[model samples]
Target: MSLDFAKLPKAVASRLAKLGIRQPFDLVLHLPLRYEDETHLYTIADAPMGVPVMVEGTVEHADITFRPRRQLVARISDGSSELFVRLLHFYPNQQQQLAEGKRVRLLGEIRRGFFGEEMVHPKVRSVGSETPLAEALTPIYPTVNGLAQPPLRKLVNQALNHCVLDDTLPEVLRHDLGLMPFDAAVRLLHQPTPDTAQRALSERTHAAWLRLKFDELLAQQLSMRLAYRRRREQTAPSLRATGLLAQQLLASLPFGLTGAQTKVLAEIRHDLASTHPMQRLLQGDVGAGKTIVAALAALDAIEAGHQAALMAPTEILAEQHYKKLSQWLAPLGIEVVWLAGSLKPAAKAAAIARVESGEAWLAVGTHALFQESVSFARLGLAIVDEQHRFGVHQRLALRGKGGSPHQLMMSATPIPRTLAMSFYADLDVSVIDELPPGRTPIKTRLVNDARREEMVEQVRKVCSEGRQVYWVCPLIEESEALELQTAIDTHVALSESLPEYRVGLVHGRLKPAEKAEVMAAFARNEVQVLVATTVIEVGVDVPNATLMVIEHAERMGLAQLHQLRGRVGRGALESSCILLYSAPLGEVAKQRLKVIFETTDGFLIAREDLRIRGPGEFLGARQSGVPMLRFADLERDTVLLEQARDVAGTLLDHHPAVVEAHLDRWLSGREELLKA
Candidate 1:
């Protein structure tokens, strides 16, 4: 039976919608935040202080008093002792409801008041013959405005009563895994005995919870596995590396490829040579030489009589890639085209024409490359940098520009192995786990904001030494709401503080041309100090720039802090990252700064970030179209994820019907998006 939300009261429907509850299953899935032992009641005399208790008593006196600040006061007795109930704010109707001789039930914590033991603002209701009470532990669910606990509890109970579920896991699998049946697990979770509820809520390790979490994870894994299977079934162009162009490009590079890069590139080359399209994730720490591997892949595609397109998250990064690729490939007579959203119509048309005619061997652009007007003669490879910035649909849209083009996604923010195994199960993974040789490890330190003058003087000292420096701020402009320093303000302040130094400013609000100009000045050594926002976190490359000062660094995420620090240490000179945080740091922020100060390993930072913020916020799931995990916590439930993956793979291979049913049940309409 479908529990139609439309049939509910208007206020109820709106409140439920606000809580993201629309379907019967959604209501059932909305588990209790906590459970209260309302089944047992205690008399006023016997009730312990400082503990929440439920009590039934007869009201002896109730009135509104004005002397002590307009409060409502009531006295109640349970035949043994009297208790005081005080409400700092109450309506006249509540006073009448608790009038003399009326029986009432209340739940609240008992505390020593001015007069005697009292329950301030206790939940109060009239006791009548028709009043129903829970015989077991009462569930307390999360609620929004206009939706109280009683009504929400009732609605959830209604949903549970009407819910009809069919077990999707095979009996043999359940027995072998020692798992409880699905229906039993659901019932146990929603309505458990007092003891079970206490254990489950307190520890969050009950067998019922384990059963439900595993099922949810299994659904996600099955969806991604199915997507992988379907993709493998499709045919793709085999782009083999003839070694002529790749060897030429490798020889031109002044430095040798790291062992990790070589190994990952070999994996990519093998995938490209296969008939199946490549859905690969190339992950590495910041400055781990992923771009070279990407370039090699592009060269392989170009040598195979096909064009390659590399799309970055931002125009600056795209331009960076375009410049680097051109410098590497122009010597070999390979033409590279640039496409961006900010390009003039004429320029864009010319670039598109080059791509269409196959005159452009490699196309480097932002999201503009995936536009409908931009087409290629033989687009065989598609490379997406910072893959987290784009959704799965955008990837598909770009792939549509070619006939199952080999896809290679690169992320500087190293994903934890567990996350890659479960969340990215659909894509084959190749990790460049090593940094290039001779790249100095960035020395990081936490500088308190009280030493702002000292830090400014230090920047000047670094600039006086002929090295460039970067001052990164979290905000672009000052906000009256937040007192955090802005990039513009910092630029102005530094310009005044160091009048002799050339300081340039760049932020996301600037026009593309303006940003490029400012960055160009910094690159050419014309600007000694460049103040910018986090826009430079990914793409800016300057060999002479060796110092970075991040103001209010505690306000930034660990992944972002790591990325910003990566901007430095790219050159031969030793680099230092100073995290200028305010005096009072939150515990999490303190830990984040400590992590950044301790290690330059991006993978460790990612794991710590995941542990601190959980998976959704770490990957930016809301913006990136990463499926929101409702039941499973990636940090705590990693074992469940692994077990679910194993079970999903086996079921898909052996019991496809059961796997499909399970996916349909848990994921419902989200199976397609979960493929990412």
Candidate 2:
């Protein structure tokens, strides 16, 4: 049976299309998550006087009474027991028909009153001899406005009754799992005895989840496999590493590079010498010398008679990169250009022309690099920092502008290996697990808001020592409606508390130039304390900042806390992070604070975050970009996910061609894009 797609509201139809719910089978498979039994009939013995229950009875006596307001009082009796039911009504005359000798079913909590026992304001419904006396179960479906339970339930039942199921699972799966046919399983799931229902529900849901997981993993593996294949197909560009400029730039550096940095540089050098284009992820914690490694790669590219580009997610970061890269590369006579949206048209045009003509050997900018007007001459390498903020399409857009540039994505978050495999299996991973020698560990402490006075004194002492401090507020601005403290309000409070020192503020709502000005003031030590939101969570390095204060710290995620802590400990001075949260924290919030206090390891924090919030919420609802599963819990469904992954892998390994056939159809449309 085909669904008349035209009957659905246009908006709903458009949404359905977006979600790939185009066919009747697609809608049917979205099964109910849980159920409630509203038709469970009971007698007085089954449900005692004071126990809540659902009962069918006939009305024996009904009357209207006025207790300052009109109300309906009735006496009802089933064949076994008698009870009183009350209906609070302003217009008692409207319920005149609900008098003696009326049959009805009632649902409510039974409670004792001045009389014997009664059900107050129970949900009542009319019933006749034709009504079923016993309903085994009633399904409660996931729903939205305009699509209520009855219609949705009816449509689903119709679909299940008529739609034919395709059992794409190979014989091996059926034999190994002892599974029933797909159609039979669907029937059992919709209608089964209580005992068999549990087993049927598990089997049907597990099969579907496994099937979907297999599709996802296979797509991932295929993408990675294709990337590897493409790299092998391309011949190595004849590029030689001339160490004169690289050595010169290194010697001119104010500080020596760490062993980890040197090792990463060598890895990049090796990739440059290989026949395949490098697709690598550079993972490091904050204050780790990733930028130095990236700069060395640029040096190698420049020495090889090609240009490189470093794309930051924001103009502030881009400008910071340009300044630092220029200081090191400019001295070696390597031309570097900075491009950002904030630049004047004339300056931007001149910079673009310089990059187009290869007059600039290295360019650093935000997404402005991919504008049609901007072109790179002999671009050989592209480095994207904070890769998560940019999607694959954006990265590909930049690569398309160059000649299949060697791509290196850098991230400050240190994810665990298991998560990395699941999230970034398509990319070759390189992790810098060691910190530099001069870097100091940040001492972390958890304190309640009651210690505000002590904390203020501590802040004064830290600032008196000529060290800068970061007082991170929870919100961007003050809102009259919200009860939470805002950065602006905290900034005012802190400024007044420490009137002797200058305080600066930075937040997302501030104009780009204004934010830069405040940050510059803090960096220059003109302001001893900077109060800002998490906008300063990434890539803003100030070595002299020795203290970090996070307000409402319990509300922040572990990863964010780790990032905020990373902002400090840059300098050789002993640094500390003060987590000030209100008292009476919830279980999860308390656990979060405890974890932050117990360990500074980003990977550990990530694992704890996953354990507490589950993978879906940890990644965030918007970030998943995948359909939410009603039957599957990413946390509790790990075993099923692993099974799904294995099944998907086996299918692809045996029949790679199936990926282009029924597998694509099974996946709706994602399979086609995955192949591409």
Candidate 3:
């Protein structure tokens, strides 16, 4: 099962193929994201503090020593100055060769340690008798688990040497753009002279990213185009509103519908009356009253003698949506069936039967709604809550269940129009920008970790007032390696801190029933505070929960922090979100926290999130159907994306039948190459 190294170039032979590197083209496409120059080698005296430096010195002293508490320290130094390098090797006997008086070269950042200044566990190398100090720019390749730096660098070098770039773009385009030849660009990209490296990266690296971005945009356009085509081809079943059931449902509503809701309902009504399947997105921020809009749409379907189904990503969300819809539609005698995986088998089967027999006009559940045995009698409208949580394939799978049910996807994450068009190109979008009247804005504040004790006291005060609180920890458990707080530890600490207040815990690892029970207890005021992970990000609304405290808030993405903040501020009482972060936050984390503190505008926050973390993390690569582009940063490559989108649109417009006529020749070739 040995890999063939001969297929790759000398520069990348060892590392490329082993890392699943296939063709020369593939190596060329896999460009280096970062580079480190070794030319700036320095001595201990010349070394700058807190900066990565290459130090060339003969080892005057080297020894593996242990401290009283069993701390292993490896001391390495030159003739003039000795430096003690600490190693977490409990068993010092294993590394016996690193003994005293061994000459070695080390590369790492210098830092002030507990004892003094040190380079802890630096990358050590044995110095040869007459070896000159090596000086060059080292290319750093993206690596996966089980793969390290040296082998990857060598493999990429080999791949670049052997690869021949078959120029795909027209010569005229290349010349006009002043682009270098593809082969030369690839070579310069891997082992360029300092000047050529920058040019090569600007041309080759960015060009490769542009190519990939173009491919992604094309795939998205094609998928959306195909979806549009297929929908157009289908003979949709028209559902006419009789007005009787709809009127009864509207009459049962406690408050009048917002103007925006009324307008959106009209649009939905028009879609239902048409013979085309409605594929739309219902985007609104938290507490924007999107559920009422969904309920109204369901009523329209139910009155037409058809059924509607709502799918939530989590059981808690499913139950929440079901409760809301049931209360709204109950007066009209509309039957709402709750279907979730946690349901007892017999009960689930009974619910399935109810939907299948048309006894239930509305169904709400998680992914279980698409189960083989759970077919609706006449599924007319399909609503998906938190659409971003589900993948494109899953959404399509749900639609496949009932003659391509009219789709309405909802997201609390308010995406900008441009991003929405790019991300959800296949579906028409409808935004609910306005929140319902009387909805109170959640005041957000940024506090350093030093204020944690005071924050806990504040939470105690809030709990004493009979209001609920949410304390979210970043991670599930404490890592022996990573210095991050865990939800379980925080739960224990909080419980101990406030002995009188009952604290409930929920996380992804908990059983469905356990999670639901905890959530229910929190909702019913049985638990005055909830200590959980991001599992409570989407659903589990406790309106009376007036306080949200996020620990290590800087570690969370803007969109995620916004979602967690959304969990509170749902009730009539004034609410506040305390973003507590560990001090010395990095630049990006600082920017994210600053933006959160600046405004509560979800749309603005989403845009800032996109700029800070890129589109991949914003919509999440797995869910958005948009792969991460190495060269083409969405923020920096806006012009290129727009160009690519325009090119694809023009090509499709002028040659509408080209993809269909030559699917294997055009699209499939690129698709197969991309897969390779």
Candidate 4:
């Protein structure tokens, strides 16, 4: 049952809800982060160093002083041994509580200081004449600001007492798998006995942790499998793949398809001819030629007497697809309508009308296609480019435009295998692993910013060879916080330093017309250098551009850096990308640089990215309104994931009541996320 929010104080209720505790049972299930061994006490001198311990003593002295900095200092003695306690930050009441001759208990890490053993800002509690030590290891939970441990601990204790602790799974299954019941796992996690090993709890190799991880994974897998089953029940148009127009487009292409592309195209054709809607993810490295495959798939929808819409994340990429597809489709007399937010009112209206009245068989634009004003005559296919940029709702909204149109979502960022299996389990995925012929591999180099002058000379050398260069800056404008080089400033500096060649600039803040003009000049080699932000990260393909210099490469992510590097090496000529990084680089940034410099394989880079940064960055907009796993690590708990995936099917097939109970205990209020 849902907790009565009105009965709680406004702030308390808000904080509890933020922690996903809308019901009393939620508090019962909210496990501890770590346990403090408050069950035993230590003398000040005998307390272990570098680990937390509980100690009781009488205050000998207390004062606020500033030798180097202002702080509160106190000396406490347990009759035989005395230790110093310092608080860098403290309240007046806390100073009073540490007054001389008062008995107190402290819990914190102890370390050897200049004078003696010391604890910095330890948890302090004034003792009456006598108080009993804690009976069990104290649990320290995950909490937000303004919520203290005392009240939260009280609520959780009450929940443990009053909330029902029934097992969601049957006794037979629990015994067969050797898994602990859900209630026992939650309880043990919250209140472990003092004898419990800290190493087992900290490392989460305990049986209780395993059970929780298995249950979490099982719930997630069940939700995805059920969603998959329900989706198949919905009806969608079965567009027959006659391969008439697809063959025509393939013949007109200047280059033939790679083996990977041919294989993926066949998969798309099979899905398109299905009665249910196709929710497929087509991903490849930046230069893997996904646009051409999607273009041919659009032709299949058209050949089946239905229209198609291609949507992108940015106007630059959208316009690039529009121009390229229009160029290819124009020979066959296919009308392609261009619609974007930047279009003039009359132009936008005309484009929408043509699409609505079936005058155009293809429509390409940014997110404007998801707008209410844009209606399709018969949107058999809705191909979204940069699927990571659009949220789950936006993609669903676009697909719902023409009564569940078949979707082919495309991404330049490849998804790691484990991530695709767990996070993207609901969707069908197609991968293009091969780069087309004549595409040369880019040599990547990591350079320190101290060598900026050498890079300037390097840029001039590439330009002198009659090839273009791209200078990428992390920021578009000046900011007091980061103080990194901005695109605007870099554009001016490059133009002045290399006066023999023209340098053009483009950024998100620029008008569409102005940005297009600069890109056009750079594409034609009229402008020898293009200075821009990540807006040029994708779809600005200048085969003549042989060099790319990225400033503050440490500030960008692995996917963004890889995409930026892909702009070059599109031509037969050898290309190189130099990543200029600032010193004092963070550990994560260093790992990203090392991975990118070591390997040109996108899949390997994606795997490394997943390891360095968990699944959040890679999941992208698809994480919206989704119930993410809290206990299971996709990489570390592969055994649990495999077992859960297997059990989810069996439970749904034979144990419907158990399935409902498991989902209720785990998902509860967020069941709709599964359907999404």
Q: Which predicted model would earn the best lDDT?
A: 4
Clashing pairs in 4: none
C-alpha TM-scores of all predictions: 0.95, 0.85, 0.75, 0.97
- Residues forming the 10-long window of minimal summed lDDT in candidate 1: 619-628
lDDT of each: 0.87, 0.74, 0.74, 0.88
Instruction: Rank the models by TM-score, top first.
Output: 4, 1, 2, 3
After superposing candidate 2 on the true structure, give the runs of residues whose Cα lies further than 4 Å from its correct spot. 7-20, 38-40, 48-54, 59-76, 82-126, 133-136, 161-164, 177-192, 197-245, 254-259, 262-277, 620-635, 642-647, 661-666, 671-676
Which rank order by lDDT, best down to worst? 4, 1, 2, 3
Please provide, for model 2 over 293-354, each residue's C-alpha lDDT reduced to its tens digit, 9 standing for 90 to 100: 89988888889988999999887778789888998888788889999888889999999999
**Highest TM-score scorer:** 4
Q: Which 10-residue span in candidate 2 carries the lowest summed lDDT?
A: 667-676
Candidate number that wins on TM-score, 3 or 4? 4
Which tens-of-lDDT digit does each residue in 1-676 have in candidate 1? 4577778888878889899887877787788777777777788889988977988899999888888688988999998798889999888788888889999998999999886889999988788745667666877787898898888877888888887766888898898888888888877777877667476554667888888888888887888888899889999999986879999999888998888998999999999999899999999988889998999999999988889999999988999999999999999999999999999999999999999999999999999988889889999999999998887787778988997989999999898977887678888999998888889988998988998999999999999999999999999878888799999888989999999989999999999999999999999999999999999999788989999999999889999999999999997899999999997889999999999999988889999998998777777666555456777888788888989989988998899889878876777677666544
- Model 4, position 291, has a per-residue lDDT of 91
- The count of backbone overlaps in candidate 1 is 0
